[model samples]
Target chain A: MIRFEQVTKRYPGGREGLVDVSMQIGAGELVFVTGHSGAGKSTLLKLIALIERPTRGQVLVEGRNIGRLPRRAIPAHRRQIGMVFQDHKLLPERTVFENVALPLLIAGLRRRDIQRRVRAALDQVGLLDREQARPEMLSTGEQQRVGIARAVVGRPKLLIADEPTGNLDPALSLEIMLLFRRLNEVGVTMLIATHDIGLLDQLSGRRLMLDAGRLAADLGLH
Target chain B: MRIWLARHVQSALASLGRLWRQPLGTLLTVLVIGIALALPATLGVLVRNGEAVAGRWTSVRDFSVYLQPGLPVEQAGELAASLERRPLIAAVRLITADDALAELRTAGGFAGVIDALERNPLPHTLVVRPAADADDAAIAALADELRALPAVELVQLDSDWVARLDAMLAFARRAIWIAAALLVTAVIVIVGNTIRLDIQNQRAEIEVAKLLGATDAFVRRPFLYTGLWYGLAGGGVALLLLLAEQALLAGPAARLAALYGGSFEPLGLSRGGVAAVLGAALAAGLAGAWLAVARHLAAIQPRV
Candidate 1:
């Protein structure tokens, strides 16, 4: 669960990225944040992820105001949130299994538990057999799947995606969307920021729209 | 605690494996670090050895008392016996003028020239060996006492040579300190540059990890371990270099000792010295890595 109250983010050069945005998403809810490029969709996600602090007001996750969190504690706050990028961002030098296991490794999990969770995550993404394959050897769709697996491997409470299917073909994008839908069905809180109107048309969820650095519309969950 | 240490160790091993995958670059980096570390360590060894040699040579306190040329041999003998009775004087030997001339003749290999001389010119001498623990002030005091002797012409304190040797050793120590400081700077720069490159290489991975909830400490652990490995390897190489230098110098040192009619053993590093060298390398490595990571990690913002 996340809540933003009058959150504002300004760039170093006095460019307003987000302004007085008030929004909330309940636990186990699937929401869509749709906006044009530079419309502050990514900035909202960054605020929720604690990557950048809001310039004004507070961003709360799980009832804790993370705006006042110490820099050292930011990592622990982030551990509860899973994030995926449009680029997949899989490490090119490591195997798919290693990439997925990174979060667990950082958590200092036992090697056995790490292997178990990594294999299960890869299985969920339909890449169990390709666990040994490097990201460079994988297709674009497969690499994105690896990124998804890596994001969800630690069983984070919140899943945030930043235009995850932006680079995928229609079929591949649909397939990735189906994966998120399945994850959502299994009770994972999901927030996907995208400009894909067609994909939005196919999904039944809350739509929070942004225009000119402010929230312009909030279509309540269908 | 055990589990934590084990995990850290595993992570360190994983990094070492990654380094091994790029052996050429790793070897080049290690060699650079080694050379940087070895220069000062070798200089330290040299200074210690030189001090050891000086210590051995100065172990005995020697002085010479020149008796009046025409003083009677009995009076000179009596003076030597009286000086020997002093608590600081360990031993004293009286040499009459005739005996001094005879010794010069034998030492100079000029028996024919001495035989051709009209008269003996050497003065009676009293050679005094003081207690080994005598200090400079005490030796000077003894020299003053000998100068006041009725039969003595001049009192020559051999301790002046020891003082000069000590001053030279002090200068050498200061030089070593300067060299060590420069080499330490070189170590820091070399290691810092290496870690900076590593940070660049792993920038994307670091960003991804940050997003996934990896703390700076978690990300920094591997680089810290890598720096430690570099330090440990460099120290090992430096120790080997020092041993090789000592071996090479041993033969020459022995030859010089033979020339001086003394036995000399080339000095090697003591256990504490070795530990100090390793500790210094490790501290330099940790500081360098910390600097590079602190500077670079904060600048990496996860892309929204």
Candidate 2:
């Protein structure tokens, strides 16, 4: 669950990332944030992950205010919310299994448990056969799936993605979206930021539209 | 507790594996540390061996007390007996004038010259050896006490060179300490700089790890272990260098000792000395890595 109340994010310079944006996504909901390049979708997720703090108001997760969370507590907060990136932010030198195991490793899971969970998460992303393959050796679609497996391997309560299918073809994008849909069905809260308008018609979820760092629309679930 | 130990072991081995993968860089860094450590270690060995040799030489130091002319042999013998009774005196042998003249006639090759004199001129003598544990000051004090006796004319100090050698050894010991301090610092800096470069090369991996909820300690574990490996390997190399140096000097040292009519064995580090060298290397490595990690790891965060 995530709640943002009148949150504004201003950068070091005069530019603003988000202005008076407020929204709430209940637990187990699948939500999509859609906007242009500078529309604050990434900023909203950044605030939730505590990568950057909201300049004003409050950002809550599971009814706890994270705006004033201490610096030392940030890692634990980030661990609870799995994050995927457009660039597949996997360590290129490592194999798919190693990349997926990163989150669980941070959690200090036993080697046996880590092996079990990583394999299962890779299976979910249909990357089971590519466990030992390096990121560079995988197709773009496969790499993104590996990234997804990493984000979910720790069994995070909430999962966030920033243009996860941005580099893929439509068919691959649809496949990635269907994979996300399956994950959501398993009761993981999902907040994905994307601007793929064509893909949105084929997938069903609530949409929050941003314009000029402001929340312009909140389309209810279809 | 088991988990903690397992994590530490895993981190240490992983760091070692990384170094093994990049053999050239690791070897170069380790070699520099080894040479730095060996400089001080060699100096330590020299000072220790020098002190041991000085101790042996000083233990045999002796002085001679010359009695006044016309002193009766009975009184000279009584004076020698009294001197020998002192706690600092190791042994005393009285040589009467007749005995001294006879010894000079047999061994000095000056029998004709000495017989040309109308009277035997050699004074009664007390050859005095100080106790083995007596210091230079105590030996000098004893000599002064002997010189103050009414029948004693002069006290000849034969161990002045021994005192000078002890002074030189003391000075060398101090110099070794200063040199060892400077070299230890050099070792620390070498390790720190190497670790800094390593952190720079792994910037991406660090950022990714941090983003994946890795704590600062977790991210720093490998680099700390990297420093540890460098220190341990460097220590090993230093021991080898010390061994090589001892081996190289063994024959020459023995020959020099033979020339002086004494046996010499070039000494290597003692068991404690070995432990000390390795301990210093280990400490330097850990400290260097800790400083680098503290300075650089905090500056890195996952940037959106």
Candidate 3:
């Protein structure tokens, strides 16, 4: 579960990113955050992930106020939630297997467990065949899948993705949405930020739309 | 803890593998470190040999005190006994004029000359052995005091070469220390620059790792290990070079010492010495890598 209680975020130069925004999504729910560019969509996800703090108000995840987490506790707090980026952000020099194994590696899992889990995650993303291939050798969609595998490898309770399909075609975006749907069915909570309105039509899920740093609409579960 | 150990091993091996992947660059960096290290190592051997040689050459820093001519033999004996009682002199032996003449008649090949003399001409002498702690100034002070004694003509010191050898050795020791300090700084700079470049080259990877929930400590592990590898290899190469240089000098050094009717022990690196040199190199590498990683990792925040 994620909660933002009247949170406000302002950038360094006195520009408002998100202002007095409050929202909550319960466990086992997959929500779509839709807004145009500069609509505070990324800021919302960043606040939940504790990548940035709200200049005002509080942000909580799983009942713990992340805004109050100590600096030393940040890494452990981050490990609890999986995050995906639009660019995939996989290390170009590493193989797909190594890229997906980053989270579990950080967790200090045994080699056997890491191998088993990495393979299963790669299989879920249909990237098992390219495990040894460098990320630079993979297609953009495939690279994005590798990023998904990485996010879900730790079996995190919540997944936060920032425009994960930004570079993909409509068909590829649909496939990614379907993958999220499969994950949501398995009870992994997800909050995805995207302006691709077509993605919402395909998935038929709850959508929170932001407009100009405010929560303009909260269309509850359909 | 076991799991932590496993991760450490994995990270260390991964670092070494990365170094292996760029064999040419790593080798060149190691060679630079080794060459820098070799200079000091070779100088260390030289300093040690010089100290040993100086010690041997100065082993007998004695003074031969000649009593005034026509002084009674009993007076010479009394002077030797008095000099021996002084704390500065370890021992003193009186050689009567008759003893010197008898020694010359048999051992000096001067029997024909000795038979022609109506009476003995050599003065009674006292051979003075200074204490182990006596240096040039201390011996000279003692000699000056002895020369002021009644009926004492001359106090000839046999320590000229010893003093000269000590001064030369002292200069060499200072020069070696200065050279060692500079080369060590150069080694650290070389390793630091190499590691800085390595961190810059892996900037993107570091950012990604940080984003994937890696601790700063985790991000730092492999780089530290890479520095360890550099130091280890470089130290090994330096040791080989020193050994080679020592080997080349050992034969000639022993031959020279033999010609001087003395035995010389060539400088062979003791186990402790090897450990010390390698440990210092390892520390330098670790420190240099740590400096680079700490400075750069803080700048590489996760790109939002």
Candidate 4:
């Protein structure tokens, strides 16, 4: 579960990234965070991820105040949450299997357990055959899928994605959305930040829309 | 603990693999490090050799004492006998005016002219060899005592040569230290700059890894290992270079010793010295990597 209690973030240039925004995402719920460019959608997700601290209010994940978390405990806190980026930031020098196994490796999982889990995650992303292939050899969609596989390999409780389909075609984007839907159905809490209204229209999920650094609408359980 | 060690080992192996991916560049980098390490190593060997040579020269105690010109030969002989009675005086040879004149004639090859001179110009002299245990203080005390003798005109102790040699050795030692310090600084800067560039190149990957829950230790392990490899390779090369330099100098040193009718031994690195060199190289590499990581890692935080 994720909760933001009147969270406000201000950048150094006097720009309000997020202004007094408060929201709660329930366990195992799929939510869409829709906003135009520079509308603080990514900033909202970052607060949940603890990448940046909220200036005014507390940000909680799984009932723990992450803003007050000690510096040394940040990594442990992050291990409970998975994140995907628009660029599919996979190490180009590493193979798909290696990239996906990174999280498990950092978690200090046994080699056999890592192999099994990475295979299962790649299979979930329909990238099992491309496990040994390098990221450079994969298409943009495939790379994104690899990134998704990497994010979920550790079976994190919550998954946050920032523009996961920004570079994919319409067909690929729909497929990736369906993949997220499947992941959500399997009881993984999901929060996706995107500006694609068409994709939002196709998915039946709670929606939080932001405009001018403020939460403009919350279509609850739509 | 075992798991942590295992991760570090894996990280090191992964770093080596990355180095191997660009063999030429890695080799060049290692060679540069080796050259940097070799300069100080070679100087160290030279200083050791110089010290050895000076030590041998100083081991022989030679002193010259000049007696008054009108002093009786018996008085000079008595003075030499008194010097010989001291435990520190290993040997004392009395050279009267006639003996001194004869030695000068033999040395100068002017016997015919000396025989025609009106009178012997040299004064009575005493040459004293001190015991091996006699130190600078003992020598100075003995020289002062001899100078105070009524039959002695002056005691010109041949300690100036030893003093000059000691001064030279001290200067050389200082020079070696300064050179070593500068080279170490150079090594740190070179490796630090290289690692900084590497961090820049891998910035995106680091951000991604951090977002995926990789700790700073996990990210830093590979760079540390890379620095270790550079240090090890550099040390190995430096050792080889020093050995080669010794070999090249050995022949000439032996020939020079033969001309002096003495056995020459080229300086060899002691066990502790070798260990110090390796340790220093490793320390330099670690420090360089640490500095680079400390300076650059914070600038690479992910935006979202």
Clashing residue pairs in all predictions, respectively, total 0, 0, 0, 0
In TM-score terms, candidate 3 sits at 0.88
User: Which residue window of length 10 is worst by lDDT in model 4 chain A?
Assistant: A69-78
lDDT for A63 in candidate 1 is 92
DockQ of 3: 0.64
* Model 4, TM vs. native: 0.89
Measured with DockQ on alpha carbons, how good is candidate 2? 0.78
Q: Give the DockQ (C-alpha) for candidate 4.
A: 0.62
The better candidate by lDDT, 2 or 3, is 2
lDDT of 1 by residue, B214-237 (tens): 888888888887788877777777
lDDT of 2 by residue, B67-174 (tens): 999899999988888888888988999889999999999987998999899998989999998887888799898889888989999999988887898899889888
Listing candidates in order, what is each one's chain A TM-score? 0.98, 0.99, 0.98, 0.98
Candidate 1 runs further than 4 Å off: A220-222, B97-108, B115-120, B131-134, B148-150
Q: Of the pair 1 and 3, which is ahead by lDDT?
A: 3
What is the full ranking by DockQ, best candidate first? 2, 1, 3, 4
- Name the top TM-score candidate: 1
Model 2 Cα lDDT, one tens digit per residue, A75-193? 89888988999998989889999999999888888999999999999999988999999999999999999999999999988999999989999999999999999999999999999
Chain B TM-score for candidate 1? 0.92
lDDT of every predicted structure (CA atoms): 0.87, 0.92, 0.89, 0.87
Which of the two, 3 or 4, has more DockQ?
Answer: 3
